[model samples]
Target: MRKRKTPDFLAQAHDPADPNPWLALYLDRSTPLPDEVKKSWLTDSSSNSRQYLLPLLRPIARGFIILIQVLKIFLPRKWSHSRLLHRVLAWGLTRFVSPEANWLILRHFHLGAQILAFIAANSPVPITTTPLEPRNIDDLKDDLFVKHDLNLFNFVIRLNQALRDAGVEMHPPARVDFSMIRDPGLRLEDMPHTRLNFLDLQSAIELFTPLYQLMLTDNDFWRAANSLQLDETIGIYAARLMGAPEHLILVNNKHPLVPMSTLRAGYRLVLHGLSTEMLHSLLMDRKAAQEQPPAEI
Candidate 1:
């Protein structure tokens, strides 16, 4: 039998010269960003200028943000994840919130998290440079790249525990090892190598999709899980910030790392008041432009 070739990403993961694992992962895209665009984004500006406003409007925007946060404290914990609550809030904001306030909050609060995560992961900090694997989950408790508002580390830990308690089993031929549950300290590096392909991705998604759906629907689980649900616009913006190509951003591409069902649920719940056309332009993949036909002279 011919020896199987290692995927470029997996090979890169093992490369010692690659100091920053997260950056390596970002660059390992099946559809990569153009070199020029990537360079411009890195060198030109760290943030969107439109995401800011005149200095005078800053205080007003801050007040609105604080009011929202204060209101959230008074809300019933269960209602925090309620779809009805999400829609109601979105609707009210759409009707009452100023465009500037909305943009400021989403940009500063939502996209800001992603920006911080990117910087932390790529920084020279040794702990942050560690490869993002199951083993290092505990170390990443406060990490922005891996742990979003939801505290993904705790979420994964709780999820694994929930699966085991529920006696959930994987499909035939792939018995549920519950490895993550069994060995709380288990690391991805310790596991045997297995080729990851589209089929594998599909199977994983299928297996976990229902579990995620159940979690979202279960008020008790959500409250105990302590996950933070984001607005659709913020979710979309965060995706773009993660170096997701324009095609994926426009279609709201569902990366396997996060559940697609959850993302769609946010879109339905929160009205960001952003048109799809505007979003497409904001996150346009310059690389994709190469595929377009030339304009007439």
Candidate 2:
């Protein structure tokens, strides 16, 4: 008897409609910005002066940012598990800057940087030493699957676990079974059989939105800290000071448009705002769950 072929679980999990369309919408490059936001982002002569001044003060800023990044790396892991510390950090960060800026910066600057880096790194590069060698598109696809797709899958899994710890129970849509691949340690070849249905997309969004909000609330402090800018200056300065990989990638790739940072910042604001709204809804759900009567046997 011939052995049956192993199914492509990843392909089976592809949903054109997307079980959480908001995630895609939030990530999309074509999403439009509001008029007022457009105006706010426009920098004048004063803005240019401030931007120029930032580099002169970079030595001082660099030291301060590095200290903060160090604290962020170490302190969060050590203290984050504490409920009090979580609340305190959340409260402090929320007040440190405008919520508007917080939302804008993450969607636009942070996520954009991550996406661009992923694209550039995964895109085909010439084998400069062997000029005649053909570019391998297969390698590019494999890299994207392993680096981008797998990493995102694991992130969503982790995010779900974090929500559960906070007393909010959320699962992917019934039509989409992620259980087989839920193990964080699972390798690509070890990936189990699963199915994804785009018809159940709305339900998945409804289920996941609360958890997404919790994530935003949890990261609000860090977001606020990173979102700060002086006029024309982009937050890439702070990222560079902290030795962020995104800055290095951007430099290496030589991305044609510096203004993409501005666009990214604007997009982040909208996405963050949406996440904040979701967080509010999640709180309400938690409250309702707490107040619910015990189930009859």
Candidate of highest TM-score: 1
Candidate 1 C-alpha lDDT tens digits along 1-297: 123232333234455765744345346545334332232222212212222322334344334434544554666554423343334434433343333222222232233333233323322221121223323212222332223334433433443455467665212121211111111233222222223211121122222223333323344333222232323333443343344344333333334244332323322212221222223233334324534699999
The worst-scoring run of ten residues by lDDT in candidate 1 lies at: 174-183
Clashes of 1: 0
User: Candidate 2: where is the Cα deviation over 4 Å?
Assistant: 1-32, 43-61, 65-89, 103-297
Model 2 scores a TM of 0.22
Tell me the deviation in Å of residue 247 in model 1: 10
RMSD of candidates 1 onward, in order: 22.2, 24.8
What would the C-alpha RMSD of candidate 2 be, to one decimal place? 24.8
Candidate 1, residue 265: lDDT? 33
lDDT of each: 0.32, 0.29
